[model samples]
Target: MLLVCVFGGLGTMVRYIFDVSIRRWWHHAFPLATLLVNVIASFCAGMAAAGYVYHTVDQATSLMFVAGFLGGMSTFSAAVSEMVSLARNRRWWLAFSYALMSMVVPLVCAAAGWGLVAVTR
Candidate 1:
């Protein structure tokens, strides 16, 4: 629990830094920050899941990485908020596109990450 909390805090900070930097450079209302965070976090989650399932990750490590870091790094709330903002602003196409990419890409990345564990192991 302590490990999870500590790592979660670290992960959240990383997410904030990463998202802020990207938002600064991109300067768009497309939710790129949330999208990137979700995708990367999903990959990490997948890998951590696989590691735990395969006994490569012990309980503390699993709690820290899976329950802590990835949980902090991913932002489902922010993603939905972005979608809502886009729709409210009448950017239907952009909203739809963001929504689609946000779903599809993360799934793909997660699968890839899980498959990566399978392959490497």
Candidate 2:
């Protein structure tokens, strides 16, 4: 539990840094930071899942990575918040597109990550 907390803190910090760094360059209205972070987290999650399946990672480690690190790193709520903001601002098309991409892109990224790991073995 303590380790998990520590990992979570670390993940949160990393997420913040990534968000700030990306926002520095991404001055657009879209929430690219959150999306990219979520995508990367999803990909890492897929890798961790595949690692567990291949016995390269144990159950506890998998839990730490998925539930602790990635859990902190991914910001689902922020994504939703951004979507809502977009809608409220009358960018319904962009909001809808963001919502759709937020779901679909991560799934595809996870699958790609999983496939990469599976093929390497």
lDDT score of model 2? 0.93
Kindly report which residue stretches of model 2 are placed more than 4 angstroms away from their true locations once superposed: none
- Which 10 consecutive residues of model 1 have the lowest summed lDDT? 23-32
Tell me, by lDDT, which candidate is best. Answer: 2
Instruction: Give the number of colliding residue pairs in candidate 2.
Output: 0
User: On residues 20-104, what C-alpha lDDT tens digit does candidate 1 reach at each position?
Assistant: 8998889877888889989999998888888888899988888888789888878889898999999999999999999999999
Task: In candidate 2, list every pair of residues with a backbone clash.
Answer: none
Model 2 vs. true fold: TM:
0.97
Give the distance in Å from residue 61's predicted Cα in candidate 2 to where it truly belongs. 1.2
Which residue window of length 10 is worst by lDDT in model 2?
A: 1-10
Looking at model 1, residue 107 earns an lDDT score of 95
